[model samples]
Target chain A: MFITSAYAAADTAAKLGEEAVKKKNVFPPFDPSTFTSQLLWLAITFGIFYFLMARVVLPRIGNILEVRRDRISQDLEEAQRLKEETDASIAAYEQELAEARKNAHTIAREASETAKLAADKERQKTEAKLANTLAQAEQTVRKVKDAALAQIDTIASDTTQAIISRLIGTKVTKAELAKAISKIAK
Target chain B: MATHPDPIKQFAINKLLPLDINGVDLSFTNSSLFMVATVVLTSAYFLWSTGGRGMVPTRSQSVSEIVYEFVAGMLRDSAGSSGMKFFPFVFSLFMFILIINMFGMFPYFLTVTAHIIITIALAMAVFLTVLVVGFGRHGVGFLKLFVPSGVPMLIMPLVIAIEIISFIARPISHSVRLFANMLAGHITLKVFAGFIVSLSAMGTVGIVGSILPFAMTVGMTALEFLVAFLQAYVFTMLTCMYINDALHPGGH
Candidate 1:
């Protein structure tokens, strides 16, 4: 590339190449062949970047995906297990409920049977008491009929004796009275 | 005839050094400044453009997307599905080189791309990566990349050696392709620009005659702009192709 220079004195123009570059105290414009820093930096930057990407960032992303997959799988499996547990519990409760219903029915039937037996025993006892009461009442009626007959005969005998005394004026003997009374009672 | 670059020499600035601890000569020079500048400009522009993140992209974001899609499309077309894995690498290289080439076109800015060392270093990095990737992926089978099928058994050794030489030469050719194109384009532009100054210095006929070179310069400038973009793309595309060969050796 052509460049214009206004700074060159006659003495400075005489010298060429390295001496001139040094006189100016300027590093000779870098030769492409000898440039080292840029290349080294390139390799270092790329190497670091590669390692970071390969070892750190990518692996982390991959691990996250793997962990997410594992979590989802575990969650699904747990859900299935919980579903089974719930189903089993439901089944167990249903069975227990049925058993309780059966037990309650049996108890109710037995209680009704015991109640029936007690009621029959009470009926029999009451029937026996009524029979005893009827017998006592029949005995009382016979007693009362016999007493009334005796009273009626005694009153007739007395009245007959009184009439006889007025007519004949004689005292009656005990044996004769007894025989008359007995005949009158019959 | 000036012996050394006057404007370039004037432009050189090495104000500060970063490597004081080891005293390892990690001085910040004019090139370092431009390198940092390029990185900053690229990062800032992309970050600012996409930072808002509207679905309907803004202008910078739109440009970013087009470049992205363009590179991605090239990768897919050249390298197939496996190229998706290395998208970030290829994309960064593309953007970096594209920016550097464009920066070279600017009047005062120094181009890192123009430097053979820079281009060759970048190329060698890509080459080494391709080597590592291919070997790492296929192990012994990767050697088959250098050995074609159906070659005569007697000449297979010669073929394999030739293949290795060519494979080794990939980085060189790749770097040279970009380096030569940029160097030629810029030199021609400088010459034509000189002519424009000289003609403008002349009174009247020089003015009219200046249009010929000026028109050619403008036209060539447009063409050079295309070439700057194309060279970066070609370098990146060839890198992908190399990587693809690594991923799927045995010529598919």
Candidate 2:
């Protein structure tokens, strides 16, 4: 069944080829009759396409590429600028931090030095006051010692006179007693 | 045998619209229809795909850009920055041929490039453009293209003659290369396919035999697709090289 049908189709195709060759002896592509039309339409279609590409399509694509490139470069530049700004701010912050640290150290050292100086002055004042009080106490002690020493000498002389008077059997005249006491005392 | 398919019938030009101007037979043939389709599809694809004009391209847009850059780079590499003036022309030709060739791959679709006239028309345009640009840029010095330097004085005449003939032959070879490739590829494919049909008409043994031709047909189809793209590339590459010669004239 398939063989018969295939033969029939092939027969029809051969008849068609014969008819085609009869109608135009030249090959379809080589036929001059179709040349004018093919050339005409090729010109028309290709011309329109070239115009669109040159004027509209290519320029549009070119613009897109240019804009994208510009955008990328711009973004990169902005990022770079921001980075530099950040770096500057960081540097300034560090500098200020260092200055503040230095000031803090100076103030601490000055405060300690002032405190030490004041303490030294106060100590000197206290020491001088103590020394003056000791000096006055010593002068008072020397005067009291001199007065006791004079009293001791007077007591010793009175005892000596009483003893001499008591030893005597009778009471002699005052002038003669005084002259003997004086001799014995000498 | 009478029971065989005619491969040549596929190339027949059917009149879609009968048109005339000043008694010219400018009827819109199947070849013309495919050309129009090629233009429309290419233009619409580029226009629509690039409508968004996004910084990051869509998939279709990427294809468009890739094609654009591919042609641009080809021209630039061959002709240098000075040759970039021909970018639009080269781009159009490449896209037109590439798309038209792809259109031909569809079953029942007419292959426009298979016709010698159309390929000739394209090649002539490039030839004429090169002539005009070469002469316009360098004047009569453009003829220097035919005289290679450092030729032995004794053989210089022969060398120049050869160069002139080869230079003149450029368009013919360029156009015929594409035309013959498309014509021969499609015809060969049809012939192989016809073998399968005729072979399968036999009994069970014949049907199994048909499998070989069928597989061969499949392989040929894939090869035809590659040839379609490769021919377009080759045509455009030759155009670039010709334009490069025109622009330099002194030989790079």
Give lDDT per model, in order. Answer: 0.72, 0.92
Worst 10 residues of 1 chain B by lDDT: B3-12
Best by DockQ: 2
Best by lDDT: 2
The C-alpha local distance difference test score for the whole of candidate 1 amounts to 0.72
Please, what are the lDDT tens digits per residue for candidate 1 over residues B1-252?
353234334223343554433534444555556666666676567556555554446777667556667877888888898877987678768877887788877877665676677788788878988889999999988988988989999999999899999988899999989877877677777677668767866879889989988998888889888998999989999988988998888884
**Per-residue alpha-carbon lDDT of model 2 for A9-53, expressed as tens digits?**
999999889977776667887887789999999999999999999
> Looking at model 1, what is the TM-score of chain A?
0.49
DockQ values per model? 0.05, 0.61
What local lDDT score does residue A180 receive in model 1, on the 0 to 100 scale? 81
Steric clash pairs (candidate 2)? none
Q: Give the runs in model 2 whose Cα sits over 4 Å from its true position.
A: A1-25, A115-186, B19-24, B147-159
